[model samples]
Target: MNGIPNELTIERRMAVPRDAVWRAWTEHATEWFCPLPWKAPEVEMDLRPGGISRVRMVGPEGEEMNLTGVILEVVPGERVVSTDAIAPGWVPQTAFMISVTEFIADGDGTLYRASARHWTDEARQQHEAMGFHEGWGKVAEQLEAVARRIA
Candidate 1:
């Protein structure tokens, strides 16, 4: 897809197969969801539309960030879209971004892309200023490592 004014993306090619990457994403998210030294101690994922998707991250200094969202779409091992636009049971909430994560088979590995689409340019800028590149890139590398281990 072409660029949207309020979207930020990360694209990575993993040496692990699609199934392994999918497992790393859905079944073992806490293993790689957050960057090292900043662990996702708890993760709750139900890979279905409207299902709960939660992650609790704790940094080296004990700074915490809890993300609670609902899965908005799922395509088995291929794709997942989640957002904080609404809470469980479709309740309205203040939304910052919608995350779209996709994994596709490429040779013996996977082509992965994750995009964060914000409702406003200001929100997108906020995410970027918050170290989106360094943070999310580390997490993606973390996911690749976890997947490689089980591959």
Candidate 2:
């Protein structure tokens, strides 16, 4: 969980300001979190350390995936790290991947970095096989569009 040995990342250069991207990430996630034909209809982001970071995705056939996690760290307009290992008030839960997202200022836009660190190598491999690059790339594109609209 400490190295790139078990991780998947999606980095993009968005043609928008860092704050705009941050807002798209935190405020308008439901509008862009999931790939099309699937939807994140319910999303909640309490972006402080120990706050709840949650999302519920519904597929075209009514399948559902709910991720309710705790925010482990946050730097306003810069970064956030969250994991599903613990619930609120330090309660324990099954651990999966820990996600770290950052926004850095570029010349005229923001550099967005989103990485998922898994507890096991198998998990990383599974994620890759599940099309992490294509899925996350599409989501990032959606996020950029949302940011542009609200900027």
Candidate 3:
């Protein structure tokens, strides 16, 4: 849970300001959180420590994946860390992974890094096999487009 062995990370150099990127993530999450053909119809983020971060993604054929987690950290326009290991009020839940997203200033744009920290090697492997890179990469692209549009 603390090292790279059980984690998967992806990064993208966005063509938008860091604040815009952060807004795309925090305010327009549902618009770009999922890969194309899959939409996030519902997303609720409190954007503070111990707050709720929930998203429900719906696929083209109506497939759904709901993720409800607790925000562990939040540095406005900089970083956010959330985990399914716990819910609001510090309630424990069956954890899948801890998600860390960073928005770093890069010249006039932003550098986005998103990491998924699994609880075990098996979980990490499962996520990778499930197209973590492709999925996350697509989402990043979508996020950049949204940020650029709203910038």
Task: Name model 1 segments beyond 4 Å from true.
Answer: none
Candidate 3 is scored at a TM of 0.96
Cα deviation in Å at residue 63, candidate 2? 0.7
Number of backbone-clashing residue pairs for each candidate, in the order shown = 0, 0, 0
lDDT of 3 by residue, 33-54 (tens): 9998999989999988999989
The 10-residue segment of model 3 with minimum total lDDT is 1-10
Give lDDT tens digits, candidate 2, residues 9-98: 989999999999999888888899988878999998887899998899999999999999899999999999999998878889998899
Candidate 3 deviant stretches above 4 angstroms = 1-3
Question: Residue-wise lDDT of candidate 1 within 93-121, one digit each (tens)?
Answer: 99999999999899998999999999999
| lDDT of candidates 1 onward, in order | 0.91, 0.91, 0.92
Model 1 residue 95 CA deviation in Å: 0.6
**What lDDT does candidate 1 reach at residue 144?**
93
Better of 1 and 2 by TM-score: 1
Worst 10-residue lDDT window, candidate 1:
1-10
Root-mean-square deviation of candidate 2: 1.6
Query: Over 4 Å off in model 2, which ranges?
Result: 1-3
Which candidate wins on TM-score?
Answer: 1
